[model samples]
Target: MLDDYGLIRVAEREAAYRYAVVAPQCPADLMWPDIRQSTLSILDAVIKKHAIDKGRVFLTGFSMGGNGVWDLAAKTNGIFAAAAPIAGWYNKDEAVHLTSIPIWAFHCEEDDVVPITETESMVQALTDHKGSPRFTRYQGFGHQHSVMYETYSNPALYTWFERNRIDS
Candidate 1:
């Protein structure tokens, strides 16, 4: 499930880690649901076939796919250990259900497509429920620029994923 501008490929294979990228087909209104379903199916297969640490499974996405990350995390419940949704939106009603996972969300203060308020509202909803989610806002960047450059340039995002694991 690759979203517009999303490229999912095998990034690395090593003794201790495997990295797979998932990019969703965008124009979000038309493709999001399909992307979600396919992604969930793939996740199920990955869980069955691989010796996934389960505790370390991470989901990260930008733009429309970022929205997918939020949706998947909320819908799948305990399946993902952590999530990073960059410049995305999640319904406040649905977002309240995300109780157990750690989320590190990113957004640009200047974003116009998906307003920063959406992220703020989500954080507020999560906090209202006593959930902990780390949020970062890039001051001058817009929505697209914030996610694209930040994700590629910073190695810390990957490290963040590696640091957490699902609680069994």
Candidate 2:
């Protein structure tokens, strides 16, 4: 999935940043504890072993990982410089807590599985809380198509990621 983000190309083309992809060993439904813990563990290891710039760390995920992105970012508290969740659903009740984090969400209007309203309501809650999160909805696409179409070649998303920093 990290390949979809052009991360390898980005790393090869530039020397200023490093990227790592963590795949949790669990099914999607069991993602809450198992996958979340795995991701956090990988993140902890990365920070400890590498000369990483904490302020520039970013989080991104698609599908189940997308859902994990929202949950993890809120729980971690000022850890990620920015988060981008693709085709993921977030709990609307937790929206306000994400106000300080920069979020860029992507989804499809015709996604039958997750439904577009999942992301819509979360984005609305964020807006209601005076948070500005960038969102993109592919008008005629479905869940898988939207992610597959946008993931690899979106130059703007990468540029946006570069502009954010957590300062923690």
Candidate 3:
């Protein structure tokens, strides 16, 4: 992600840096192997075509996508540098699969659509598994998409992702 360079292509220390935000929204479900594989294929294609940095690859999502983030992180643990799932939900048992990777999860305490408990349970489970995951619990958002506005606007989040990049 490199934290919204405004453009996907930019120059950093005279070296050209390229990044892409590929959102696979089809089927709106991340559990489907076809969709997950297809998304991976798409990323692979983009990386090979554009020479994207493998170590900087990050995963994120909102709502259902947030839930997908947890699932995908578990299934593709070593593949992503880090993950930021907003208002996502997943089975607590799956926490074991995600213990090794860095995660930053967000959720509104007042969320009516997907209760904050969903995120809490996951975060708690991850911690129980000895995984130190970051959690940002906001109040008054109440499941509204405004949570995204507040989150994406923060520069620190992007920098956090950069710091967590995998070393190749």
Candidate 4:
């Protein structure tokens, strides 16, 4: 779910952490399986190649990639150390599965393509299920506001990822 940024944002964090960026060729509705497969394959490869801390495996994405983060994080348990989905959406059915995972979601108030309510609803569903997830909402931003630019521009997001880990 690389969306359109290619390797721009993900590459910036490479100096601090090992990560794999996935570029999805499929359309949005049919992207789930490919995203899941690519992510799992990357995880397997990273574990085998690097003598790294398994608990520190983090996930983040922009736009459609962000949506994939929410979907995958909900589908799998204890696979990611933490998740940060920028302008991502999810269905209520995926709420319960995300209870144990630490999530930090971001969205803009004026995004016309995907309404801010998408992220809000997911957060609200998780909250109703007694799951607390950190959510950041921008006041005056649209679809092109926060995903790649702000998330990368701010160090706090990276620090948030570093602070969280899956309960192993």
Q: In order, what is each prediction's RMSD in angstroms? A: 3.5, 3.0, 4.9, 3.1
Candidate order by decreasing TM-score: 3, 2, 4, 1
So what's the TM-score on candidate 3?
Answer: 0.85
TM-score of each predicted structure versus truth: 0.80, 0.83, 0.85, 0.83
Candidate with best lDDT: 3
Q: After superposition, how far is residue 121 of candidate 4 from its true place, in Å?
A: 0.4
Error of 1 at 93 (Å): 1.6
Model 2, span 4-106: residue lDDT tens: 3434545556555446544443474576555666777887888778867888888877776678878988788878899998788878999878899999988
Per-residue CA lDDT of model 4 for 1-168, tens digit only, reads: 344353455465457644554344436457765668776776678776875567877777777878888888888877788888888787877889988888888888888888889999999999999998999988776888455587766778778877887555
| Total backbone collisions for each predicted model | 9, 0, 0, 0
Off by over 4 Å in 2: 1-18, 23-26
Deviation from native of the Cα of residue 152 in model 1, angstroms: 3.9
Residue-wise lDDT of candidate 1 within 1-168, one digit each (tens)? 223243232143222335655343546356566566777777777766876666777888777777888888888877788898888898978767786888988888899799999889998899889899999888877876545566644667777888888778
Model 4 is weakest, by summed lDDT over 10 consecutive residues, at 17-26
**Candidate 3, 125-162: lDDT as tens digits:** 99999999999999876776677656765667777988
**Model 1 Cα RMSD, 1 decimal:** 3.5
What RMSD does model 4 have? 3.1
lDDT of 2: 0.76
Clashing pairs in 3: none
